[model samples]
Target: MRQQNHKNTFLKTIPFTSIFVEALKQSSMWVSSNYIDGNSQFQGKLLLKVDSQWESVQLNLHPEKLYRKGVGSDDYTSYCQLQACFLKKFTHFDPTMPNYRYGIRLQFGQQLSHLLCENSDVFKKWFQFLRRFCIMDKFARKYKVLGKIKQCDPVFGQCLFSCVRVQDAEYHVVKVIDKNVITAGQKQNLYRELSNLRKLSQTQICYIVEVFEDEQSVYILYEYYLGIDLRTYIKESQIYQMAEQSSQGLDEKLVADILYGVLQAIQHMHSKGVFHRDIKMENLFIPEKKRLPFVVLGNFCYSETTDSTQYKKCGTPGFVAPEIFRSKNYTSKVDLFSLGIIFYLLVYGKLPFEGKDQEEILRSNEKCDIDFKFEKKICKKISISGMDLLKGLLNKEPIKRLSAAQALNHHWFIKMGTRNQRNQYLQVQRGKSLSTIIENSVDITQSYYQSNSQLYQSTKEDDKLDRVEKEFIKGSLYDKLLYFNSIQYQPSKIRRIQQST
Candidate 1:
């Protein structure tokens, strides 16, 4: 309620209404610019930037280059010199005269242009349009073309594309689902994911912005987060450090921040009856540069609604909770167990359950026999408080495992207030230093997800029949959503790779 109140208060301060914004988008008037040899009324309109992820609306005198590109490819041109495009710092509005009520000057580095909208209403429309364009569109289809975030896109299913809303210039990522490649069952999974994301979006931790679909595709848009996942960050940053014997793993404070973020995400999920069956380092993000301790927890593929039922087997080998393998009735405690694996790895610099192959790893994980090997390096990376929290989360007994809310209040977390500990953080960064790592493209083919081919090859005929029956039910539920007027969907069931009738 407090958060909602705060949001309402913040929004109330905004000047324009939706009607005013719409008027600005459609309204254009004669505009004069103070450019060298520029006409007092140059051929210009309230122009939306032709090619931009950050949809920018400028009073243009002519079609202008965003800035000079240094003989780089078109991709480079799109992103480079974007700072020059936003003239908000140099913009000011005041009435010089009745005829020239709105005066706007835009300065970019050395370049300068002054534009005027003589009429007051038209000028306000332009002003409001300019102010609001920086806000990303509420819809996914509204995002125009931007460079691909990954070096190579996912081959099939949901392909992730990097995008920006031109108006607000806010970075957004789009997950594109090709309807053709997906079976009706696969389509149902998509809808389930969509439903989960929508409910979870209210948490504010979820950056889901919008969803759009047509006959051929479904696009789920999300606010883009810069940092890589905890797994990638540690592998890239610490593997070499470990070789040099300088650091054992992520420092104590760093781990705290990452875990705090994950805890917050999990807490919200649990409150909403969602249990993330797969919570691991790969799913936990590290906000290395961000002072806030809370890192983003994402990837909802294996998460499901936790009702009173024994869950089927799912999730990655090392991270899946032991009770899940038992196939007994369980609750959201499974997520806490998965989170413990992440906690241990961050401190120990290695997975607790290690094996030569995934099968061996699964066996080790099923036993729930964690070998806590203490070393000087581990001591340096974690403290008694940290260790206690890890132990509480990792307890094999579901009843004994710490709930997300309980975990958040643990002394390990309570010693530091959830908010206002930003200064202790290393530096303020949004994954820019690690941006070069984008070139190190992942092999999409050998991805973490269980491929359709692998599943088919491994399953027996009876297993396939069971899968078909389950999918048919899910597909019918998803089809029901299509008949609805909106995307207010409830996931009829959870993702269960193996289940009993």
Candidate 2:
């Protein structure tokens, strides 16, 4: 099969997580079989189709998400975590009877459990999805799921995984969204965006490589790039610490470097008449391969052409342009306004505006009265030219705000950054810094959120906001342009699991 693993086996040493066992969002697709580990095998029904039901046991497996075969059974209170499963697909099969064609022998320590699936197609899916929880030596074998890149987003029913294409051994970030949860409109929007992204892939610096959909889900694959999102980068960097001390804004040079690449990316989109309504730090990816911070803009869920009119009130609250709130007729300048928010963060070491919750933040954003309570102190951190660029981009009036192209030509870029820094950013190359803050840091977002702990947990008033954002804002089909103030788009990269000491 073209969609098959190299050895048809996972390395025996790779450790697995219990994510699959814990996430019971979908059916278990398991049946207790008498043919399992010794006399402990209990009888149960596999949810095979009622029209052609067969008395057999079957299961879906993957290393990262180890399936507990006997979970949710009244008789079998204990969980059966699959340690190593020996899968044998019989060449011969029969639909008339339970003459098994697929054989799966699962081993859990000293405990052994065996399952037989009647359908060959279902059996293949079981083997494929249950492939690996870790990387492969040969660059994670293409089309093979190496491991989960991130947990499922509660509101959107989407998650990310790291997969590899076998032929070229290129790693990809697979965005899996459950088709059952989203609305038809959202699905169409997704398909249309994916199509647009494909056409732009050849020209754009970074974009989704391909998209695939089946009966249950949509998978959008992105080329694997090392580094973290700007949101996480800010929170984990010395910036957060400095902010706590009410320290000065970062170096104007670094701030300019961080924004240079992202601006060019937005400029390219705007030139093509596309407006990325969502330009928050979470949507901006900074590659860590070089000291110079290179940025990649992603997540076109809210992006639309200049002519297309929708999601007028759609965007992350604090970063959204004021024109978006004033009128639905906002132009591509909205993106430049959002970019201004990122600039404010890089300079001030915190968001430009803040409130107890989303409503307050949106109100603050609408006024476009940048909270310069500490403007005097902040003025010391950034140059007059730098502050001028920030104010220009963030201008509430779309007609007045600087365009992406203009922002590139702004004196701040020319004055604060070298000619090489300004031009070299368009292409992913060297430079130290924003080039933004790069770190081998802990899952800072994870630390912030322990119990459904949302990002930037220092603020408790945001609990209601987090719940609303995570639960889909009451009957909304599409995931809102979330205004949680602290919800970071957590993306994990493939790292070797260190051998336990």
Please provide TM-scores, in order, for all candidate models, with all chains considered together.
Answer: 0.53, 0.53
**Which digits, one per residue and each the tens of the lDDT, describe model 2 over residues 73-180?**
433322333312222232323455455556444432222344455576656655443332211122223378878755343235438787888777777788777756
After superposing candidate 1 on the true structure, give the runs of residues whose Cα lies further than 4 Å from its correct spot.
1-141, 151-158, 202-204, 239-250, 286-294, 308-310, 379-381, 416-501
Model 2 off-target regions past 4 Å?
1-142, 151-155, 201-205, 240-249, 288-292, 309-311, 376-379, 419-501
Which 10 successive residues of model 1 have the least lDDT summed?
489-498
Candidate 1 residue 205 C-alpha distance from true site, Å = 3.3
lDDT of 1 by residue, 209-321 (tens): 65544445556676676467656765676653664365434456657766777787888888767787777766655443553354576777666776558656788889988
TM match of model 1 to true structure: 0.53
> Which candidate leads in lDDT?
2
* True-structure lDDT of candidate 1: 0.51
